[model samples]
Target: MPQNIVVSQPEDLTVAWAQRVVKLHEPHTLVTQVDLVSVEVGTTTRIRLAVTYHAETALPRRWFVKLPSLAWRARFITALPQLLETEIRFYQELAKAVPIALPVCLAAQSRWGLGSILVLADIEEHGALPGEPHDVLSAAQAGLVVDGLARFHARFWHQHGTVPRYRWLAGRVRQVEDHLGTVLAVPLMQQGLRRSGAAVPVGLHQAALHYARNRRRAMRFLSALPQTLVHHDCHPGNLFWQQHQAGLLDWQLVRIGEGVSDVAYFLATALEPEQRRLCETGLLARYAQQLHSHGITDVDSGQLNGRYRAHLVYAFEAMVVTLAVGDMMPTASNLELIRRTATAVEDLDAFAALPI
Candidate 1:
């Protein structure tokens, strides 16, 4: 019943390439309607179900099934399967090493290779969420998120020094920085950014022209550092705080990189420094201490925190993104990031005066 849902088959169950996953994940549900909820529906294909369950008793929870974008929606060399695989691995790996309380992943499949399918416990709807956007998280809400990141990062303090794959993700940011000017000439990213709130700054408007060149410079710095498995995007939207437990979503972006990357990016872009400073050190120390508890005593909190401060590159990226994405549908925490990054780029002249 949703506006743009493509129902390619007359049989009712299978629709285009999405049938395999639909029948695979939930065979019983008589799916009556589906909605594509995310703002970036075009980049890849996704469907959200509103089903009529055949169960007798009231179900204890709700689950959502996600598969690779529809055939016409495929982009970027079919990385969707690998994307799901890495996500499953991240949760499996993180749970084993760190023991953080995360939503139980019910089932995941990479049968389609780069075109993956996943059926995960829908934590937000089950746990009770507003299902809307806002500007700030209360103090307790923020604590729930930072504590999880703190604990999540703590486990990898041992064995893995720095993850190669993670460093590659950070480098991709430069690609965004690089072909930006050329790509901005296109509309998808431009449309998304224009609506995200934080606008592109004037001086850095042209910096994206040299993205490939700057990427080498930026990643060379990240590559020389210590590393571990990190939940790189630990912002509020990806974190869910329920009554008894908290959960993290969208692990597709997980990577092994500097401890500083998550810390700085989270602090700089998710919370206002002034507000985050209150509990930032304490939360960070807690993360380090958690690492020590796991026997990775060699990890230094001061060094970790120091590098985190230096890795504010994303802060610059966030400022410019506001222009392309429009109002960013910011969460409360993201609002702080936008305000702080704007001041840093304008008042402190950080990105404006950078020696590129």
Candidate 2:
């Protein structure tokens, strides 16, 4: 086993560390410079590295690094231990098996109760860029994302029990349910609910309350559906686009759950209401067809639709909790996400779809 490298600060990214990262991709590559390009600190510390090599080599000129946030509040809110363990394990153990594109993990290390460091190939150089949070995706762009998600989910469909390696992907839903009450009771959650009243649809207001009140039931209903690996946070900001196809970023929330939950969340948060309405059914069909192509023949269309409807509420609940606990993005971006998701819930009659 390779020993884990300890890196807690930007200063720790020395030439030796750069060499290690480059060696994984090209053994003969020599790293000459590790220039810091940008630093973003939120739930995680995202740093962009501009590199200089001693000679022409296969190593990328730029890389992206993810490390534990230095902020005390962010550290507390993010549950750094679990988040780091999950992301590192995904890159190390599951990235190869996934069919869709993901950032190439050059180096990843995690330590319980401490922090983690992840170095990855900078997809930005490959024409991939993060989706703007406030900009809703066009119908064609949304279709590509759904297709990628379907391929990703189909790769692990119904294999959770058969594959011991996937056992780690379990338990996130239960963990969320276990902590839902505390999350709801927090002052931040209450404040967010009060501030968001004007944006939430009148019909779905009571539905949101139902989910908050009947947390266990809501979680159980979604969890009981067909299981597949899902990017639990598939919102626009965690996705990147290049050449009309979408690639996922931020694997911290990866889990084993109903794959339609990802679809519902993505459609609700990433599309304008008009675009979603025009393209949702078609996108769902596209997703199902992709699954079919991957030999997943048991998913009934009606059942999938029902689950998609129910999971819209799941997406709404998740956004509420997210907006409550932390400043997930800029205020305008976060509010837009809440508004769009609420609109989706009411439009789909998601409250009636899964009556508590």
lDDT of each: 0.48, 0.79
RMSD of 1: 7.0
Per-residue lDDT over 176-266 for candidate 2, one digit per residue giving the tens place of the 0 to 100 score: 5357444553454456677676777665665567567776676778788657898888899888877777888998878888899999999
**When superposed on Cα atoms, how far off is each prediction in RMSD?**
7.0, 2.4
Which runs of model 1 end up more than 4 angstroms from their true locations?
A: 1-46, 56-61, 69-85, 88-98, 112-114, 128-135, 161-213, 277-282, 318-337, 344-356
Best by TM-score: 2
- Candidate 1 global lDDT: 0.48
Clashes of each: 28, 0
lDDT of 2: 0.79
TM-scores for all candidates?
0.65, 0.91
